[model samples]
Target: MDTTTNALRWVFLFLMHHPDIQDRMCTEIEGVVRRDMIPMLEDRSKLPFCEAVCFEVMRLGKGSPHTAPHTMKQDTEINGCVIPKGVPVVFNLNSINSDPEIFPDPSTFNPDRFLTGDGRLQGTEKMATSSMGRRSCMGESLAMMELFLFVMALVQRYKIKIEP
Candidate 1:
């Protein structure tokens, strides 16, 4: 759990310092949500900008760089690489997520890529954070929901700024 905890802490600290992201996130929240109403799960679909920010954060955030381990059940080929059955596989999420082919200019933190021309999330489905097969992480839903709420609450409260 240390890996997960440290990753989350780092992400929190990074967001706290990044004024551009904080300003954009707050503006998006303020535009969609009334000040009086607390953000809820129902608000998620209506808040595409919010979702995009969260997606960008997740993409950039190295939360749990070392994902939980999994063992291969049967022989499989992925990306032209073949593995025999019963081989231990460590899915380096960091590499896959930050790969340039998958995310252009992967090292740069940009939220605009996730948005459509009209300022909505471009993807129809959430990207998978864990393995697709039988050994996928079980906490996917819980983690996503928690992260979303935490970010929304932060936006609702603080108007973030960079100290010069």
Candidate 2:
């Protein structure tokens, strides 16, 4: 493969293998879901643990890492950095999502941090980081619902094993 293609492939694998995020995902799913009970869309809102896991996953995944870019329509300053008018800019999702200040122990995937002791999201307040806004992933809701159903069905109907 060409260098560009090879580079893309490596990046894909790196995201897939990100240990802190990936392991927490598996652990959360394995904990709340039993080997029975088919997960449904109706069940999503009730699945606090599952939702938390999804949030943390998205935070770490930083969906489409380098895909979204925007342009400055007018000269602007953000976080003390100034941008010239009409300048192109890219938002590196990973950096924002994984900021240690915004997310305590950002590198560690801890879904509980997104939740309360009663097992609800810390708040219902919407933020761009909540996957809302012009830059939001259009398919976020559909993809999340699909993933929950798919994983639940697989675990209920079959035994999955990881080989050493």
**Top of the candidates by lDDT:** 1
**The CA-based lDDT of model 2 is what?**
0.56
lDDT of 1 at 124: 23
What are the runs in model 1 whose C-alpha is more than 4 Å off? 1-11, 78-81, 124-128, 162-164
Q: Kindly report which residue stretches of model 2 are placed more than 4 angstroms away from their true locations once superposed.
A: 1-37, 123-132, 157-161
Put down candidate 2 lDDT per residue, 7-55, tens digits, no spaces.
2333334335554544444455566556455667776666676566555
What's the true lDDT of residue 143 in model 1? 67
Candidate 1, poorest ten consecutive residues by summed lDDT: 124-133
Q: Clash number for model 1?
A: 0
Tens digits of per-residue lDDT, candidate 1, 40-158, equal 88888777777776776667776656566667789999999998898887877788778787778977867777888988788524344654456657776566667677778877887
| RMSD list, candidates in order | 2.9, 6.5
Q: Against the hidden true structure, what lDDT does model 1 obtain?
A: 0.70
Query: What's the C-alpha lDDT at position 117 in model 2?
Result: 84
TM-score against native, each model: 0.80, 0.66
Deviation from native of the Cα of residue 154 in model 1, angstroms:
1.4
